[model samples]
Target: MGTLGRSGIVRKPNETMRMLVTTIIGVVFGFFIGVSFPTISLTKFNFPSNLIPSLNFTYMDNAWSSVTGHRQVNSLSGVPKMWVETNPRGAERLPPGIVTPDTDLYLRRLWGKPSEDLIIRPKYLVTFTVGLNQKTNIDSAVRKLSENFQVLLFHYDGRTSEWDEFEWSKRAIHVSVRKQTKWWYAKRFLHPDIVAPYDYIFIWDEDLGVDNFDAEEYIKLVRKHGLEISQPGLEPNSGLTWQMTKKRDDTEVHKETEERPGWCSDPHVPPCAAFVEIMAPVFSRDAWRCVWHMIQNDLVHGWGLDFALRKCVDPAHEKIGVVDAQSIVHQTVPSLGNQVSRGITLV
Candidate 1:
C-alpha cells in the first residue's frame, strides 16, 4: 500500500514487510555461520559424546573429518578400533595367500573348502609324544581334555595306525617320525608362529596317569594364578624327582618348596621355586614362543631344559608353579630313555 504525504510517496506496509524479511535473514545467516566455524579445534578437543542431538557418532566423525581434514577415530563402523586384529605374521602376509601360520587339527572335506573351521576354533592345543605301548594311558589323558582342545600326537615308535582304534583318533593329528625325541619334533613342528592360534600348549609324555587331572580345570587354575609355565603336580610317591613338582596335600598350588640342604643357593630359584618337570609341562602361548626359540636344534633330548624354562619367565617364582589340585602320576616310562645309541651320538 502507498500513501501520499509530505515525504512524497510512502510505502507503509511494504517497508514494514522489508524490515521483517531482513531480520529473519540475519538470524538464519548468523546461525549457519556459527555452526560452520567452531571456535575451538574439533580435532584437538574431545567434545562431549551427547553434545549433538539426533546424529550418528560415525556421521559426526565424518563431518568433523570433512571440515577439519582430520579424524581421530579411523573406524568406519562408528567405534574406533583400539587394536587391530591381524594374522600372527601381522602386515607381512605375502606369498602364501591361502594359508596362515596358525594351523589346526580340524579335518576338512576333500572336495570342498580346506577350511572346515568357520564357527568353532579350538582354543587350546595339547600335544603328546607317544608309543603304541602307552595307548591306553594316552586315551585316558585325551579324555581329560575338553572339546576346546585340539590333540596332536607325535609317534616316536612309528605306529599311527593303532591310534585310529579310538574314536577321537580320527580327529587327532599324528606326526609319525620313528625314533626322534620329543624335543626334536617340537623344534621342527611346533614353531611359535605355527601354533600361535592356541591360547595354551600342553607338551606331555604319553605315560602320564591323568585320572586326577582335568585339562579345563587345570587351565582355569593356571589363569587364576597367573601361571605362564606350569604342570600338574606329580603324585607324592610317583617318581618324585623334584620337590617343587611334588604334590602338596594342603595347597591348591605351590610356587616354592624346600629342597635338600646345600642343593639350592637361592630358595626362590629352580628345583625349589619356578620349576615344572618337562615330562608334563604346560606353557602359555607367549611363554612357549620364548621357550621354542631357546630350544637348540642339536640338543634334541632337552637336557637341562627344566632349569632353562625358568629363564623364559621373569620373576620366575611368580609366573611358574605347579597346580596341585590337578595332579598326575609320572609313570616314568623308559620309552625315550631306551634310545641309548642315539642318546650317545644324539644331535
Candidate 2:
C-alpha cells in the first residue's frame, strides 16, 4: 500500500485511540432509561478514538455498527506466521491452503521474477495522480486494490488524516507533486528514484474500482502472453469503444454455434477507448521506456496525452493485449467534450 501528496514527505500514521471503554452496567442502564448517547467527531469515523462512542444512539451509528458487527474469539497455540484466513464477501471462514508442491511451482512460474538459483519475486511499481481541489472516492478504491498487490498512491494535497491508516501499514509512499499539474504527476512516474527501483509500472485514474481484482494473476497473464502493453478486464457497457471483427460462416452451423457476433481489435491494435486511461493499466518496462522516449516535452497537460501516448507506442503494431477475465469498474463521469483538436481521425 502507498500514498503521496504535497507535503513532499510521506504522511505518518494517525495516533491510535487514546481511550477505550466497555461497560455492561452503563449499557443496560442506558438501554432501560433511554438516555442520550455521546457523539463522536467526524474525524473519529476514519481514525481510532479513545472510546467507542455510543452504538445505541449516535449520529455515527452506522460506523459503530460496521466496526462491531462480528467478533470471533479463538485461542490456538503456536500457529504458523504464514497462516491467514479468507475474508471473502460471504461464507467467511478459514479455507484450506495450497500445500502441494505443484501449486507452489505454478505460483513461482507465474509471477516470480528471476532471482538467484530458484527464488523468483515479481517487481512492480504502482503510480497514481491526483489533481488539487478535487473530491474523490479514490482513497477507498485504492485501499481495495492494495489488499493483494503492492500499491503506491500519489496525492497532490498534503493534509494528513486518519483515513490514511492503510497507507501507513501497507508501505505506500506519499510524494508531493507540488501542484496538481498533469506534468508533475507524469514526471513522478518517471522520476529516477521511482522508476529505477521497479520492473513493472501500473498507472491508473483515482476513481477506479476493482471488484474481483488480483494483481498477481494480472501480471502472470501479461507475461504469459508476452505483451508489452496490457489492460485490465473491461466490459463493453463501460462506455469505451472497441473495434471488433465479425466472422460469417452460414454454410456450417453446428450445435455449439450460438449465432453471435464476436469483437476484437483492428489489424493495427490501437486501443479503442482512451490509451492508457491513467487508471488501472499495466505497462512493462519496455513499454514505459518506449513511452518515455516519445513524449514531447512541451506536451504536458491532459488534452493530448491519450492521443500522444497512443502515437508514441505505435500501438497499431505493439503487443497490446486486453484481458477479458477480470474487470475494473471505472467511476468516470461524462466527458465535457474533446479538449484538444488533434487532426487524428477515429477509425
Highest lDDT scorer: 1
TM-score of each: 0.69, 0.46
lDDT of 1 at 195: 86
Compared with the true structure, what per-residue lDDT tens digits does model 1 show for residues 277-301?
8888899999999999999998766
lDDT, each prediction: 0.81, 0.47
- Model 1 CA deviation exceeding 4 Å by range: 1-105, 112-119, 337-347
Q: For residue 309, what is the lDDT in candidate 2?
A: 54
Off by over 4 Å in 2: 1-122, 131-140, 143-150, 161-163, 167-170, 178-183, 240-266, 269-278, 297-301, 307-318, 333-347
Error of 1 at 33 (Å): 28
lDDT of 1: 0.81
RMSD per prediction, one decimal? 11.0, 28.8
